[model samples]
Target: MDSDIFRHGGNTTCDIKQFTIITDKEMRNSMEYDVIIIGGGQAGLAMGFSLKQKNIHFVILDENEQTGMSWRKRYDSLHLFTPRSYSQLHGFHLKGDPNGFPEKNEIAAYLNAFKIKNDLPIIHQEKVIKLTQNEKQKFLVATPNKTHKAKQVVIATGAFYNPFVPNVHDGTANFEIHASQYRNPSQIPNGNVLIIGAGNTGVQIAAELSKTHQVTLSQSKPMKSIPQNIAGRSIFWWLETFRIGRAKPNSFIGKILREREPLIGNDYKTVQNNVEIVGRLSEIKEGKAYFNNGITKQVQNVIWATGYRNDYSWIQIDGVLSNQGRPLHSFGVTNVAGLYFIGLSWQRKRSSALIYGVSDDAKYIAQKIQQHEMK
Candidate 1:
């Protein structure tokens, strides 16, 4: 929470902000609460803010040992595509520049600071392994070490649950890593690096690595590049001006926007000369990666930035999730009583999963939990 931490980023020797982790002795076993929130990332914290306002008895169970582990584990040199103004939670604005993009560490630090400022009750390293309801309709939340009871449960785990890599690549590359594992260019050996998926993460990593290594970017679809700013204004401002960023998922404009996600920053443009952009990676056999366009290249290293999908198999409640392990919900409200979801992509609007946007869903879910208790 120190102001000095944000001042030092990118080639600087400053003490990086570290969060306090709750010790095991401090953790109470078999506790009861009005609500139990799964996942202590931004989504859970936002929900905490809402429940705290209502004086609701709740606790957040985080899998990580400390706060903001989700953002801290991201690849180094990662900057948010949305500016700081769009990358904040409810009642807490991110420190430093509002128009400038924040680095990954800065965001992580902010999350820790948010937790401290609000004094939210969080149980660190308590990963929820199972969630079900008892005969009396009360929810039972089980962790690796303890089982807690709650009247209601909110699954605040964000959309990025698991790293998804296509099975096209064989064990031919000398090294392979997912975007979650990538830290910096130093982690990669001196060889040609092939990055799969043309999402923002892929392009950003490719740009950073291109300066030191030969990087090839494989796109499953056509790359749609959008400038970070337009006429000295952040692109998010444009989206806000037209209300496109907050458009409802079922709306006509939202339907069109959801069809394809355009790259938000110009990182790719700066490294075009250093990196090679290729078509969809169809297959990789014997160290040779074949593209859909008939282009082939010999790659020694592979980095998969193919995005992520949510996993809801841990919830033992029937009809709460689909056969594909996807949560069955209508804007965070599930079919089952006292069970809800938040921080889902397009849960209510385009930014439902975003830091600033998730607050709306959190507040709505908190209200639903309050109503359930009254009934």
Candidate 2:
């Protein structure tokens, strides 16, 4: 990376005095740009594609070695909940079965193709470790080696960062894994498998594995599961028709959207096949799991498909995050000037964080930066 190839211009004279390497914001060499996007996922690509359309001088920095590693890292059996018709980014249609859900690798390939189609300038392996405002009022994107400067910044890092790996004592079950680690039914040790969290992922995985091994899905509360399609049309058609997917987070409809997540894609609820539905798992002890309904199961494998929490600890700015460590932003705009966030759940609407909604948020942000620069 050019950032790693520094100008041998800074103080290099050998001295008797010992000095620690300076990584302070004030000391690093900064590369200037109109905008800097921190992530390389769907959100970042969307924003980059939009900004490119506006002729904005910007760069998207991703930590991973590959542009689509985000999706490639997910469970093998996973596919998007939205059909191909509604799962596309702005520039290109997500290729595949238009009415069917795209597999995880398919989505990743689509994103990578989007990056290429839009000719986005994304620096892979440039993981942003810290972000702060420089004395010049520009945002500083700090990587391990160098700090890049930007007039405006977009935190397009997707919402799902830290996977919620659950800890339970099964007295050394054959094996235990989080849903993120699960690939197929064969990966689980030979025996009954207990899948936690009856949300979309848990339900779908359980249904798939049940065909081979005995599977039980346990959940505390019932999640809202909507049919993938109503009649012959896809559910997305209805969502767009009613504009329910575009509801604001603070709106009544948005509240329900955020809370329930409204499981879709699979018909696990109606026809569970070999899957067993159980009540909340209350305790894990003595090599057994006790349920709230007094049902006990001695399972060989436990799949914690619970969920994930967002961690923005690397960002060092006041007012950008609340005490709970959640970003405070309206749509993609943050309280800190020139700093914005994208791909957050309900960032602008119910679908803002999804593959399709990312385009709208990115376009809005691009427009905002253009107007700001024009002023």
Candidate 3:
């Protein structure tokens, strides 16, 4: 008899089969599938659609309790940097003005509806803890309570994982929150705010908070600013019209563009007049932030928009990730035979991580999986 323990809802655990229910036995037995995707975000859902088109039996394992939790958990005032036309998955158009940008909630709702409309099979609240390949070349994906066996696995967890906050803040701020955990200005204190990292998220939040509070933005490096609209059309239109959006990462144009990501919005302009911009944050001592340029500010609250790092530690497979824990693959195909990754920034082109670009990678990956099975 197998001595494996059965766990249910993270509360009950039992090793004796007599004490465990029939469903527990079923849970103990690994659910076999042809393909297993380790995320349920837009990338995973998009891959599901492609796999479904090819009649592949696959399942999306989502850590969240419901679909679109990733988007729903973002800042309340968040909006897509790309327009609706460029914010859609395969086969379904995001409703409303194609030229207009969608709100975070709208994107979340659309993702949920997309999963329902496509009838994609997803197992929610099953966060994959460990992924290892057996001698038979079958992947054993272990969650807290269940283990799934799949012939192939796709990691669509996207680029964001653990929030990356530097050691600049020495626990002196009255209150601090990462941009990932920030909701709105109301959630912040009424005093002056210091936002570290001048990325799009940092700039947008600084602009928003400048309306209600004194704000200072900390810039780590010089960020190129581009207008949201150029010549009365979205900048994306111009990029697409000139084929700049499709530039491969290895190309000269792609190399130049990737050198410094240009901020795509007028929010920087909006904040320039109201918010005080400073250089890199050197450190925080006694709730006072010292800049590298010998400037200091007394801030009541701090928001770290320092971005995220992809944590591939859960993926125990060798030769799939680089020394820095980034996926090492040509586009999405990894060196490992049955392993693949999607939704990585600059995975194939400039738009590989964007909503509109994932379908292309998904279709390609689904075809690759089909071909592998056929062989």
Candidate 4:
């Protein structure tokens, strides 16, 4: 937590730390793989396993102490809307109670088992600091400990790596909070809470906190939300059966639905209508939120579910990223040779972001990698 590393706009400023390049002796001693996946999340592990099935050598690098560390660190009550069957990794199905959605801990355990069962090679506690391509087209992945080179690199870091919190007007000096810092409802102060962002995360947290605290949700735009169940079947079932969940993000219907739909979760109409819903918060001053409607409310806690920014600042490859910070890729193939990306939203279709649909994107990327290798 270096205070100087973060700029005034809440963006992180990078000061390159000293790194030790792997010497020839170290490279000879260390195991080299055909592919190096930088992340151990569901996508990373699944991609690694797929590569393994073809007997393609690959290694997974994770910053955490263990697999599924991201899920394990999330809030306790978090549960996947998609049932266990659809959420399982490649080559294996979840064996637990299929009727129920898996909790965060359950998913973490599943990932751990997936890694062990398939014997996927993973280096935990290694954070990738810099990723640059050498003149020879080998990926130079530098971690805090050492630098390793790989023929190909897969950026499987999930979308939620960075949490976005809009700046509070008075400065976030007093209210020590961010969406990433929130673990549970108990972490919120014991008073009325004003939550900005009516997306899934905001809606879920509002519903949970409504049980004990006075909660209000502020929305910048109307959201589309489906109930957990509809007509004796889970909403997810309908989405899967009709392939609504797999629709392309760029499709006319997808664009229309995404714009008109309200943010719905597992349960239908779980949020009480009586709960206050207001316009977006314009600013926060002296522990109160000022809304666009000129209304002011004093609150002890504010949860910003604004959204996330793609933070690939560590990637040193030029021309791989657009001005907007999103990777410039077609079907996960970046402009850089041997660098591929999967699990990104709208990478192929609208469903690419969903847990159940990520596998399709992963498979496509894997096929591309295979074709590139054959060349």
TM-score per prediction, in order, is 0.92, 0.87, 0.91, 0.87
In terms of lDDT, model 3 sits at: 0.85
By summed lDDT, the worst window of 10 consecutive residues in model 2 runs over 1-10
RMSD of 2: 10.3
Ranking by TM-score: 1, 3, 2, 4
- Residue-by-residue lDDT tens digits, candidate 3, 1-375: 111111112221222122211232443354998899999999999898888877787888899987888898999899988998778787466767878999998888888887765667787788999999999989999999868999999999997889999986788999999999999889998899999999999999999999999999999898779987888898888998998888899999999989889898889898888999999999999989999999988889999999999888989889988888888899899998878898988888888899988888898998889988998
Stretch of 10 with least lDDT, candidate 3:
1-10
Higher lDDT: candidate 2 or 4? Answer: 2
lDDT, ranked from best to worst: 3, 1, 2, 4
For residues 1-375, write the lDDT of model 2, one tens digit per residue.
111111112222212122222232423343877889889999998888777777777778898988788788877778787888778777355544678888888777777766654456778888899998868888888899888888899998888888786665545666777788888877887888888898888888887887788888898787667788899899888988999988999999988777777678655654265778889888777668889999998877888888888889999888999899999888878877788899998899988888888888988988888888887
Candidate 1 vs candidate 4, TM-score winner? 1
The clash count of every prediction, one per candidate, is: 0, 0, 0, 16
Best by lDDT: 3
Deviation (Å) of 135 in candidate 3:
1.0
| Better model by lDDT: candidate 2 vs candidate 3 | 3
Q: Pull out the clashing pairs in model 3.
A: none
The C-alpha lDDT values of all candidates are 0.84, 0.78, 0.85, 0.73
Query: Number of the top candidate by TM-score?
Result: 1
Root-mean-square deviation of each candidate, in angstroms?
A: 5.6, 10.3, 9.5, 9.9
Estimate the TM-score for candidate 4. 0.87
